[model samples]
Each structure stands twice: as structure tokens, then as C-alpha cells.
Target: MGWLRGDCVGRGSFATVNLAVCSQFTTPTVVKSSDVFSSSSLKNEKQVLDRLGLCPEIIRCFGDDYTTENGEDFYNLFLEYASGGTLFDQLKNHGGRLPESDVRRYIRSIIRGLAYIHDKGFVHCDIKLQNILVLGNGDVKIADFGLAKRTEEKQSMCECRGTPLSMSPESVNDNEYEPPADVWALGCAVVEMVTGKPAWNVKEGSNIFSLMLRIGLGDELPEVPNELSEAGKDFLSKCFVKDPRKRWTAEMLLKHPFVADNTLSSKTSSPRCHFDFPDWVSAGTASVPCSPESVEWSEWKFDSVRWSNCTSPVDRLRQLVTDKKPNWSESDSWCLVSRHQRTV
Candidate 1:
């Protein structure tokens, strides 16, 4: 009955996530954790998904908890499980580039998710291919709200916090940065989508300056293959603009001709179920090997799966299925999932 897969969907400075299956409901879910204290302490992620109003490009948060276990407070969270994995993993596994049209639609999804985040007044500070999740359908979802901050308060530059390669020029130079930075990240992701690697990456033992030379000062934008249509090149040009102020916003990018006029010629497959049981079932708790930094999360502490503000593990969870009030914040769900510890 206990079917959870514990592979890192994504890793932030403070958390890790794994895929899970809620056999009881026959629905796929994700689990995550901060791994500091008890497994019960978690933040539900469903609230974020609900709050964002359903961007198919972003992973949906389903349930979560923040509670005390073993005299320690832990944070656990959960969300929709993506079986297809992340764009980064796909890039490595697919081996050798994506078609320009395919890249366009992928970028469109990235923008749609970002647009939803911006509309909800949040900044997905950590936007990267690793955080871009792919579903059974070709659709993509942005995961990992651990570093996401929901605020209208804008920062003027160096305040950007995340992987540097995808950062905007202003973010890299410590100038005023805003939502536009996300576009830059999207552009980097597009580059990776088409090239099968990061737009800008430093070699082992290389200084930061050298990497910057390839991105900040160099013509890092890959040549739009001669095979690409003019509209595709134009879209990339807009994103690669050096001026952050002039960069496209999520909404603006969505209105681009490449996307607004594009159609999905390749049909999308409907959802298919993925379930394969194991020989061994966990006794009381399913515990997996996690880093000392993650020892707590690697253990199953599911007490705080939901808050009073939401539902409770003690109450008949099935009953809540009748009404629409059953959901949790993204952070909490991650904390909860981290404890289940199933890796497939």
C-alpha cells in the first residue's frame, strides 16, 4: 500500500523532493522536506497551486504539514507527482538538442508558469531546467517553491538569489532587477533545451571571470540554426537583449508570434497510470538515506501532513474529498514528502 518514489525532483539550499504515489486515491503526489527537525512539520504546496490558478506549466501543490516530531520541528510538503522528470534530466538522457519549434513551446510553458507566478505576486527566484518538471503529457510544470518569495516589493539588483548562469545582466552585475530576470532565465533554459546543455557553464577549475566572459561579455546566445524560421530567431533576439529593462515580460513573451500563432502538430497523450509495487513494505515508517543535512527528512515523519487551517491526518481524509477546501501550501507538502523516503 505504501508506494512512494524518493528521487530528487529538485534540490534547493534548504530542501529535497521525491516522487510519491497515494495508492489510496490512485493519484500521484510528490513529497519534500527541510530535514531540520521532525518529519511532521511540513508546509502544504497545494495552496500555491490553488493560489496560482492552475498553470499547467507549473507543478501543482496538493498537501503539506509543519509539525513536531521527536522534540524537533520539521517541515514536509507534497504536490502532483511528475513521472516524466525534469528538463535537465531529459536533456542529459535525450542526448543532443531539441528542435526549435519544440524549444518554442517549452519556452511558452515556462512563460505561462512565470506569468502565473508574477500575477500571484511571487518571484520564482530559482528558475532553472532542474526545477522545470515534465508530466506524462508533454506539458511542463515549475516545481520548488522553497526559494519563492511572494511580494510586490522589488529589489534593485544584486538581491537575486539562485544559480548565476540563468541570472539577468542586472542580477549578475548587482543592478536593479525585477520580474524581467525570469525572462533571462527562460532564455537560458531555451538555450539548454536546444543545445542539450546550459547556455553558459564554467569548466572545472575555471574562474568565475572566464564563465562570465562566455555569457556576460561574450556572444553566448547560440546561433539560431539556419534551419530555424525567422520568427524563432526574433524571439530569441528579444530574450537575449542586454538591457533587462527592455527584456520581455511573461505576458509580452506569450504574445510573441512564434507562440500565439503556433499550433501543436504533435498530439498530446492522455494521462497514464504508473504503479509498480515492491517486495518490502515499510514497518512503521519508510526511511531512506539522506544527507546529515537531510537525515531528518530522509525519515518518514507524517504527523504534520496538514494544518488545522486545512485538514488533518486523523480525520477521514476521504471525506474532505467531497468538499473543495482540501489543500496545503507548497513548502509544507515538500516537508511531508521528504519523510516518506521512497525512491524509484
Candidate 2:
């Protein structure tokens, strides 16, 4: 049976992702296509995904083909369709920022995928929320390997790769890319998944040079949202270390307390205890639910928070264990800091 193209679902710099129906296939699949003149990236992505083989945390490549329409040869790649769309879309669905439990689960899947990718000798240079697809089962798979390259491949010391927002400090400053570069991007992606904003208070078309400077030379790291637990912040710390050599790998991050701690165990009887909020911690005037939205946070004291004990992963997925930090400045400007808007 011939392929029947459906509505356009997404448009990218190199290709357009479309929902398609192939009479030979039972389940609907997505087709990412680019004209022959501009097909190198698409071809590269397909080859990389094929080399990766089968991975639960990675979108499956279902082969590729080329078609001539109106004299233009269009190359296409068939991929597993994720009905839940991208993690970025999920963030929007939650009105910016997913729940800690959801973030933990998704991050675990991402770490698994990254680990497998690294083990296979490839580096997914592009690892952002938009590049992560979510299945109908709520499981996430890393996608968009257009920028991926073999770990052993050497490039010019000054050639930068990957999305600017998620580029590692080393990649920005020295053009050094390794498995750790993906870890750095993974950290930035986690921040966006939790806070509904890019790691830095910047966008695609803004002063990229200035952003790179802050990422490369400045001492200031992206401001961690007050909503995250000590473990969550520390997890980010491992990813944001200026030295790529010291950055935590996906395998190591999968074992982090932020992802493994079962404080809010679904199987445990004390589900409310997941918040880990002490009775003394409350809204200045009332007892409100301890959520990212409820905290009247103003200035952030990044240096003062104490970390929680990292625990091993249990059968059940865990939620963040938030503790009261005395350093957060109390102010009415809390509303302004709750969510940072972005253009991308």
C-alpha cells in the first residue's frame, strides 16, 4: 500500500514532521522529510538511529525512502509516532513546569537513553525537551539525532554544535565535545522541564554571544527554581560544573537522589509525606499547599541550601523531598520569579 500523508505536525530547520498512514503498517507513524537538495541531516539522523538499534528510551527508526513530487526528490524517514508529543508540549499542558514525580520519571528515561547512546559510541549533541518525544504510555524517548556524531570523531577545536540554549560551557568556550557534553545539555533540559523556561534567562534570537559568555566565563549558574528539592538542585550542580571532565554522566545521574529517592513512594501509605515539608514551613499568613506556585519566593540564595540524603531507587518512582531554606528572601515579587517566559 502507498503512504498517505496527513496534516503537518511540526516544522523544523531541516525537515517537516508529518503524521502519515501506510497501508502496510498497522499503527500510525510519523514521517520526517526533506528535499533531496537538503537531505543530508535527515539521512544522517536516520543512519544514526539505525545504528543505535532498538532502545526502549529511544524512538525507533522504521526505515526510509525517497519520493519525487513535482520534479523535487524528497527523502523521508519513518519513525515511531509519539501521541503525547514532545516534553515541551507536556510542559505547556501543565501550565509550565511538570510535577516533580513526572519530571523524575521522564529524566530517568532520558538518562537511560543517553547511557545507551554513549555505550553505542555516539553523542546526541541535541538533547532538549523539544527533541524528546512522549509515548501514549507516558514514557519518554529521546529524538532528533540530526546533530548526533560519533564520540570518537574529531572536529575543529572551535566548531560549536547543538542548540545554543543547551550548549555545554566547554562546547561554548573550547569546542570540546564528549559524552559529558550531552550530560551538560541534559542538566539544562531538566531545568527547563521543571521550570518551564530555558536554563538561562535568554532566547534563540537574543544576545547569544552574551549568553555564551555567561555560560562560559561567568561564575553565575542558571537560577534553580525554588520548587526543586535539595537533591534536585544538587543534581543540577553535577550537570552544571564548569569543567566537562567533572560533569556527571547519564548513568551516574540516573542514580541521583533526585531521581531515585522514594520519599513519595506510590506504594507507601504516607503519600502526603512526599513533599517533605516540615510543619513549621508555611505561607506567612496561612497554611497553603507546598507547591512551586505557593512559595512566596523572592531573591534566591543559591549558596545556602542543605542537601538531602541521596537514596537508592525503589520499585516505585519518587517525588522530590523539599525542605525549608532560610535563605530565600520573602517578597511580593514572588509572582514575577515564579515563571520566566521564553520565545522559543
Candidate 3:
């Protein structure tokens, strides 16, 4: 890939940094990776995604090719650019927290994505917020196949590789772990999304011993927010459990009451605003993008004045929530307006 520094969105240990590949490629397109990893693992991820059959929720794999600059070959997996940015960005920006409802949303997406992957015989060995990207329209995509491996749907012991912050205790201990390890990381990501801090946020970043000290051992779990719905609390508790066998399944979490149907399941078809959200949703910055045809999106209204002015989260929140009406044109750019729940 002969891309420039401007194409760079991220850098990593093994691959060429996340750089925009196409020149004047304005709309964001994730480059297929040119990185290093075990052959079976990469092959597993490729076959798994291929079995997924072009899912919109998952990033699209453009093509696999060689990196001329690095002189090493790789499977190029390109995907959509989530302009709103990462869940990690949102969590950190707000001092390590977000609304519980929003956390539920992202977690739900994680479950769905994981289910799809697992259904196709693969385990996302690395599941973290940084690997979760968001589109402007509120949907999410799971990235980073470098560590993914094909596996049977059943649970079992598996080795692990990823940041310690999201590592499951079983995986951290180097025991036999399986898909449940990913669920554990998903739980960690969810907690971080709502609290804005890792389960064990301490002073020294390099003090591995110190970080481990914060992570309670077998049968010792962190204190979760009791305010979470019984379903939410129970769901995370199962996910964070020390025993992988005792952990919750991604499918089970998908069906949990908290995530049952929050996507479009509100009693009234009103937009999901942040006015009276609980501590977590009130705190997090993740959002579900509104489709223009969204009847729920059109009817929602808030203080545009506040959105247009202010220095606090209130103002920033209003900006993302604020609906922008597309300007009407006399000569419509390719007009064929068959009404289908118009937002305007």
C-alpha cells in the first residue's frame, strides 16, 4: 500500500498503521490489514467473515492483497469508517462513563456480532472497545481479525491475546477458555462504556503487578452498580464470572430483558433522548444513528438553542441528538420522492 501519512487513522504493533488508502478517497474506507499473525488464525478469520455473507452490521471486506511497502503479504479487509469514532473515545472523553441504556445498546451489538461470528465457527479472541467502531447512524462494527480463530460453537479452553483491561480472568490466567472469554471482555467493555473507567483503573499504567492487584482473584468480583436493572446486573455478573463454564452466552445476553428490544421497542414511538436518562446513559456518549425514514426520529425535538450554544456535555449531547434537516432543492439532485416515513 503506497498511502501517505494523511491516510493514517491508527498505528499498531504488527500491521501498517490504520491509514486511509485511496488518494482523495474522501469518504472513509478502512484499509485491509497488512500485518503479521499466525497463518491458521488469519485463515480462520477470512473463512469466517466469508461465511457471514456481506453483513451490513459487520464491516465489509474489500479484498486481500500484498503490502508492497512492507514486502510482506496480508489479507486486506476494508470496511466503513465509523465517523462518530470509538466507544473508547466516548468513554474516556466523559471521564469513564456513559448512560446504561447506551451501554446496553453497544453491548447488544456486540452480542449480535459475536453470535454471527461464532455461528460461523470463529471466536473473536480480542474483543475490546477499541475494536468496536461506530457509524454516524448509530450502528457498530467489530474489527481486528488479527487474533481471531475459527472454533466450534461449543465452549472450551483457549489461549488468549489482547489488552489486560478487557481480558477475562480465565484467559488472563492462561487456562483453557473459549468464546466465553470474549463475552467477559464484552462485559468489561460495557462497564467501561457506562463508568468510563476500566473495572480496575489505577495510578501506574506500567505496573502490571499493580493492575493485577486491582483485578480481584477467583470468586472475587468488582462491585457493579446496583442501580442497573436486575437483568442488566445479572447479565454482567454472569459475563464477569471467574469460571468460563459458569459465564453467560452471547445468545443469552442478546435475549436479556435489558437488550430484549430497546432498539425500537419503546412504548411510544418517540426518539430516545437524554433528558431524564439514568446515571449511566446520562453519562455515556454512545448513540444510535437515526435513519431519516425514522418516524421516531422526526417527532423528537429539543432545545436547538442549547445545542447551538454551550460548553458542557449538555451542549455536546444536544449537537449529536439535534436533527439536521436536509435543505430542500428546487431541482432535486436525482428526484424520485416516494414517501416512506419521511423525516422532514
Evaluated at residue 296, the lDDT of candidate 1 is 33
| Model 1 misplacement above 4 A | 1-14, 21-26, 37-50, 67-73, 151-160, 175-177, 201-203, 209-228, 263-344
Please give the ranking of all candidate structures by lDDT, highest first, separated by commas: 2, 1, 3
How far off is residue 121 in model 2, in Å?
A: 0.6
**Worst 10-residue stretch by lDDT in candidate 2?**
334-343
On lDDT, the leading prediction is 2
Instruction: Please report how far candidate 3 places residue 243 from its true position, in Å.
Output: 2.2
Better of 2 and 3 by TM-score: 2
Candidate 1 is scored at a TM of: 0.63
Off by over 4 Å in 3: 1-6, 17-28, 32-48, 70-76, 152-160, 201-206, 209-216, 261-344
Q: lDDT for every model?
A: 0.54, 0.67, 0.53
TM-score of each: 0.63, 0.75, 0.63
Q: Model 2, stretches more than 4 Å misplaced? A: 203-205, 264-344
Model 3 TM-score relative to the real fold: 0.63
lDDT of 3 by residue, 199-279 (tens): 543332123333333443544555455455555665666676676776667776676666776653323221232321222
- Residues 11-111, candidate 2: write the lDDT tens digits: 75446889988877667699999888777667888989989999999999888998887888899889999999988778878876788888888888899
Which 10-residue window in model 3 sums to the lowest lDDT? 299-308
Residue-by-residue lDDT tens digits, candidate 1, 180-233? 777777777775676554454333233333333444453344333334455655
TM-score of 2: 0.75
